[model samples]
Target: KQDSVVEDISAGCGVINFKVNRKLLVQEDVKFGLTSELFNTLKRGTTLVEYSSPNIAKKFHAGHLRSTIIGNFIANLKQSLGNNVIRMNYLGDWGMQFGLLGAGFGQFGCQEKLKQNPLQHLFEVYVQVNKEAEHNEDMKQAARDFFRQLEQHESEAVSLWQQFREITVDEYQHIYKRLGVHFDIYSGESFHQDQAQEVVQQLQSQGLLKTSEKGTGVVDLSPAGDMSSVCTVLRSDGTTLYITRDLAAAIDRKAKYHFDEMIYVTDKSQENHFHQLFHILLAMGHSWADRCKHVPFGLVRGMKTRSGEVVFLEDVLDEARARMLHNMSQSKTTKEMDNTEDTAEKVGISALIVQDFKGPLLSDYTFDWDRMLQAQGDTGVFLQYTHARLCRSVLLKITKLYLAGGVSIFALCDLYSYDEVLYQSAQDLQPKHLVNFLLKLCHLIASAHRELPVKGSSQVVAQVGRLILVDSLAFNIQLYTVPLCTKHKLI
Candidate 1:
């Protein structure tokens, strides 16, 4: 007799039926305070969120995963509250790095290996080639020759690099989608190569350009021609430096999107790079330079597997899924589970995401499996199980009320459970939602850490009485209590 949709999200006067229209059965819009307001106040128009800019044909590292997930979360949060959030994949698709990567890829690359395991193959070839190129004169000379060829518009190398770039992007796009990510723009450094020269010309026109002894072009920010006040735009060999492309890319984004705000998510090391880039932009009279922000986070260490090596992102996700399914095998609810694959995928990602999100963004930490999988503590499993319990608990209470003189029953565990979930989501609450969340989470932690003494263990009558009392109290306590949270935890 049971089916998909719940009887009603809000109370209904009409008879409940499975075939009822969704619009008729539920509220058209959900209500929450300030979530809508905060998002709207941040942006005047569409906001650009640039993330996961891993090098084309390079392995997407753990740090890249952090930036991708965090940026997407920010974007989703903004969009949900009603803003035109534009997700952009700003790939590191140009510069001398690519010149090196392209050169290395060409001399020692394999098409069959690349097609089968593209990222691993690319990394393997690049690393071996780079190592050899470092000490061996011939390899270094060949790499330089190949890069020079690419610069000169040699059709073979350029075409090969383009193909590698295209294939890698396609592969990453699929992977990102699996992780619930999609980018509206796939802009690259290569896209701004032509535009970079125009930026250089503009800098020179503003008397911002200075020449170095090596005949390279740089910007003079200091009174003297020291390196501190200036950044190298064009290398001594006439090649563009990394910041050169970045400056140009910023200008390009401004021109194209005219974004009200643009955020760059990367590691904390890039603070200086971004500072210089933004300063140069503001100095160049781009008034919208203030709209740019760099949200840098700490390093993630010990992101490895049983093999005792740095794990690939794909491998880690596979492990998460496997571990989650193994956990599911022992779960009492799994036998009643409707969609095993979908549930496994969701729970696996939740496990991974909650680990990162459970801590502060600025604190460096090593990744661990045992810590993230805890069920009796403040883990995703705990949160999810609590949610499921709330569904059942609320139904139980309503049923009890109906049997008790067909009158109202007091709201108990449901409110506490609601507050717990709300706290995790950063919903507005009494006496500072964040503080309440931390307090409640602390209460839950205390309960978990506590040891209980059994009363009347030998007497059967007393044992049964104590069991009933404890069970009743547990139902009520679980309904109102929150979980443990640290001062550093954000959302």
Candidate 2:
């Protein structure tokens, strides 16, 4: 066994490293998390991850899906290495749009439509109501009045919007559960509505807020915006801006959680907005301002069916599972070997996640089904196939033994045999290197298992040895299944 380099150094009083010379016992089916080796190397800190924020009554798109998975991976990694992690889902359940949804659902929204196609049908009604209001000033007043009613605690408007939001959340929860994701906080812009006013007061008191030429409250980001396009904090009608909501949200989270740091994950277009947000907080004297981060991803073209073509996140999962099922059906593998539907979801989702994470986060990517499912190359299929092979091999292992003194290298009547090439190849390879190797080894193992024979070893010893080998192989395959961090600290 090799000791990590840090094992010999004794520098800090609170922590000390010492070494013991002993056999390195292998644990069965163990998943690595917060190992002493990891904690020793990791610098201490806290982190916040904000992701998977689909707006109220809006279709959950690929971008939101991406944020959900990526932010999750980051939070998982940070927490695994002993950092305080805050997972925030900034749901977009607010704004004048809710007003439109409430108004439309009141008039022409159908019960069946709301049940079967909630987000889309509601969105349809919302778009129509907005268009109608834009052309018919009376419709505009109605929409405004609808929003005001909701704002002023009007029972009917509030009740409908609440139902819409609840149904949307429940539906999304089902989808997220299927996808193996969860959020710690569902902090929305609406949740910060009251906090936004206080933030405004703080800004006003700190002299960060100003009355712009247009009568809306502005944040004096003029110098920050490079002499043009200053940022807005409040509309002329006194409604808070999106950035204002974010400022209040950050403040609320920090005050409540006392996080060591926080991260906001969104697209690049919001870069300027988050910058102004952090600056406003810094001006308000939150020293943790330095800890806030906005992780931006690139544009995804053709994001809607109405826009000629688009990719839905659910569609992506469906395609991946379908393709996986098709491949399994074509394979000579028995149904007993793999569940077509269950394995389909696992393998499909793994493929999706692997593809999304293969490239740098800030880079744009084209979605291609074939590219993601290729079995002969780097892919989730390849990875899963590798895992399955390890499982089978562990289950298939046979122990070899010899008579007390008669066993020879090759002269025995029954000699345990291994593919010379495969055995030789596995020498310098670590466990991870074995996954793809297992793919190639499948045929070899199948043939070898049939042809090879055990020698004079008793069945008990042989069974025990074989079981131990299987456990070793399973442990190794598990190591491959774990995701690596951006810094490659662990896998």
Candidate 3:
């Protein structure tokens, strides 16, 4: 009886024979494992994610791009799992780099250009000043003096630095909008400067801090009695280093948010830095330091735009949007939409993200735009294209089904096939699993749409069954894609 029922309603009058539970096909949350019971029992808590920590007055490079999207993905995943996630962009807004930039700005910086093109002008000034400082001791001294003034909170120095930070942040926020990323907090090394000194003092009081032969303050992190590894918290001149600032920031975040876990997303190059950081915190008697994690990713080579090698995050976003638009214009399958530009932007970004995420996070890969944006294959464009195709197919049939009342849409689908794939995708956080499943679902959907007679005077019950299937597919697809889009405010 079950076999006969499957054959009767299967696509193309028994060409695709499969069985499905009617109730399971209609209940999306159950199919996706996001039921209320699961949430009620899950142990969810606060999580702070720090990512895309771009340096102030510097280019928001491709490395930061990786951090931004990866962090966003992590944040989205944690939230979906019921965790209270805080998205943070820890800007590198302090240190000697600022001293160089400050001194350079005083010499070659223009108020007009700085106001007009803040990052570019500042980068140019930094480059120029760096070259001059290498040959001129006077220029070097000026950098030191300017940095000293900044540390001392001199009005003029602080005001200039503040302007640079504000302008750069404003620019980054706009660009992050294009990539669909946002931050709850924009904390930085500067925010921890005072706290860093206090941390040093605390370490001193606790007898954990010791002076090295070079006059720098070091913390012993070795497991053995002999010091195998030491973290340098203070330089010879009493200035706090990057790790010191990080320690202060971590402590501050824990105290303020009381986050159960904190994750730092950066490149693999800084793996050692984080190792030392967590070690120092543990040595300082902060047991909660073990909850901290550093999620390191690999590099991308040959990412460029028409102008040249990509420098700013804006360039990468623009390049993706522009290339996608061009591809859409050339493709016969491209649909006419009121917001084609916006669609292209989403699709383009989707392609870039999928391409990067297709491999293991720790493996470096050469980026190729053409490969990423291809219409067919395991590319992001393919995912977006499939989604768009499914949307059109379902919407057209849905209108017909609505007109044909009392139809049983849930009856026609082989829900077991799609349900298993969706379940597995959700369980495996790797996006490729979801991607491959989506591709298979799209294939099955395309075949069903072609074979199923939904257009002319179809049985109302059959139409309803098809509608149930399409709605289920839409729900599942959005379950994965919506988070990416929502991060960028696309939905």
Q: Name the best candidate (by TM-score).
A: 3
* Residue 91 displacement in candidate 3 (angstroms): 0.1
Model 2 sits at a Cα RMSD from the real structure of 9.5
440: Cα error in model 1, Å: 5.6
lDDT of each: 0.64, 0.64, 0.77
* Model 1 vs. true fold: TM: 0.73
- Candidate 1, residues 286-349, lDDT tens digits: the string is 8788988887877988887666566356777777667777888877766566776666665666
Better of 1 and 3 by lDDT: 3
Q: What are the runs in model 1 whose C-alpha is more than 4 Å off?
A: 1-40, 213-215, 222-228, 331-341, 389-491
TM-score of each: 0.73, 0.75, 0.86
Residue 371 in candidate 2, Cα distance off native in Å: 1.3
Worst 10 residues of 1 by lDDT: 482-491
> Candidate 1: which pairs clash?
413-479, 440-482, 440-483, 441-483, 441-484, 442-484
Candidate 3, residues 357-446: lDDT per residue as tens digits? 777677788989999999888777777766665566556545633433332344334434443443343344344555555556666666
Per-residue lDDT value at 81 in model 1? 38
